[model samples]
Target: MTTITRRTVEYPADGLTMVGHLALPSGHDRRPAVLLGPEGTGISDLQRRRADALAELGYVAFAFDIHGGRWFSDPEEMLARCLPLLADPDRLREIGTAARDVVLAEDRTDPERIAAIGYGTGGAVALELGRAGVPLQAIGTINGLITGRPGEAAHIRCPVWAGVGSEDPIQPAAQRDAFAAEMQGAGVDWRLTIYGGAGHAFHHPLDELPDQVLLPGVGYHEKHAARAWRDVLGLLGECLPSSN
Candidate 1:
């Protein structure tokens, strides 16, 4: 196993100091990198572990923070902040760009090889990065924002992979259809995977079971989460091959 170094990374976003975590693999090789986005609750231990896992896979991974340096355990508090942020495109752009710049400036990141994979609000940020015309190798989101802004999705120039639960209350059938239609019209190479019987934020298994039930239509399915991770890794392999 390669030694992975997890470090603290703080940057400015949302009028606050956002603290992210960077995981670098042991070696001098400038590997491909991934900008990981956390769920609305903010950067928790689960996200840090995710960055560590990505580093173990030999990719320079940085888990971006959502709500500054603080994490909200209360669902209402989280929603109060996340719901509003999700509605604003400019705010998402500012947050996503800060994290992208942080990873791009890292010594171990291959400038030409970068991808963004996020969950919920983080995933929307990833999509925003692509919509903002940033040339990303790939974009993967698990239960993230599926809808695109008017005439903005045309700027996305890379492949996008979005996974959602069929029973996800937040992402209804209408929204899914609209997102796919727009991506198709824009000619973006995008694929949407609907996991049967799953709900929102299904990729996170490390979260407590009690809290999972608290969030309506948000549950953890080990099988689906594993499958989603595999899909995300496959997308990265297809777009940003580690050999390159």
Candidate 2:
């Protein structure tokens, strides 16, 4: 097993002191970096574990925060903070860019090689970064199929891959269609995978978060979660292969 080192990083974004988790691989040489965005509820240990897993795979991984250092156990509170933020693309871009900068500042990160992968509202932030013309090697979103402003997606410079549950009410079929149309109209390289019978946030294991509210259409499927991780790995490998 590769030796992985982890630490907590503090930075500012949108008037909040954002706390992020950074994971470094075994070596000192610069490697491809991934800016990971957490779900709408906020940064959790789950996101940190994902970053560590990426480090074990030889990538400099930074799991960035969306809700400072807070985690919302109430659905209404989470929505109160995220709903407005989600409607504003510029704000999302600002948050995502802050996280990206954190990854870039790391000594082990390759300045020219980076990707953005996010979940839920965080996924939307990743897409916003792409639309803002940030040079990301790849963009991957899980359960965040959001459509951007008119003609903005044309600025995206790399392939985008999204995973969602087929029965996700939060990201229904119509929203998915609109997202697809935007990508297609912009001539951007994009792909979508709908996990059959799954629901929103299918990639997240709620069992690990016993206090979390069980929102409608939000459940976890172990099989699909594993598959989604594999698909994301494929996207990263295809777009930004990290050197061992």
Candidate 3:
């Protein structure tokens, strides 16, 4: 295994002090980078581990934070904070851009070769970045099929891959179709994968979370989670291969 360095980075975003996790491969040379976004509950060890895993693959990865540095264990609180943020594209772009800038500031990052992968609310943020015309090599989202404003998708220059549970009530078929229509109309290279028998947040692990934190129609599917990770890796490998 390659040695990697990990650190906590602090920055200001959305009227709060944001704390993000940064992981870098063991080398002084610049490498492709990924901006990782977490679920609405905020940053967790799961996201940090993902950053480390990306670093092992020879890419700098930064797990960006939402909800400041606080993890919302209360379902209502989480929804209250995330729902509004999801509805506002400008706000989402502000936050996602903040994280992107932080990763770009790192000496190990190849600014021209960065991508974004986000889950749930984080996925929406990644989409927002693409919609805002941020220069990204690729965009991948799991259980976050949120669409953007009219004609905004035309600004996305990178290929997009989204994965979601077929039975996800939070993002039903209508929403998925709308997202597809938007991407198609904008001529963006995009694809969607529907995992059968899974529900919202299927890619998110719930074992370490509190019982009360499980929102309605949300459950983790271990098989699909692993599959989603593989799919994400494939997307990254295809769109932003490591220089090493």
Question: Against the true structure, candidate 2 has what lDDT?
Answer: 0.94
lDDT tens string, model 3, 1-244?
A: 9999999999999999999999999979999999999988899999999999999999999999988998988989999999999999999999999999999899988889999999999999999999999999999999889999999999999999999999899999999999999999999999999999999988767776855467778998999989999999999999999855
TM-score of each: 0.95, 0.99, 0.98
Task: Judging by TM-score against the true structure, name the best candidate.
Answer: 2
RMSD, one per candidate, in order: 1.7, 0.7, 0.9
Per-residue error (Å), model 3, residue 46: 0.2
lDDT of 1 by residue, 111-206 (tens): 989999999889999999999998899999888855768889999989999989999998878878988898889899999999998998787764
Q: Which stretches of candidate 2 lie over 4 Å from their true place?
A: none
Compare candidates 1 and 3 on TM-score and give the better one.
3
Clashing pairs in 2: none
Tell me how candidate 3 scores on lDDT. Answer: 0.93
Q: lDDT score, residue 152, model 1?
A: 90
lDDT of each: 0.87, 0.94, 0.93
lDDT of 1: 0.87
Ranking by TM-score: 2, 3, 1
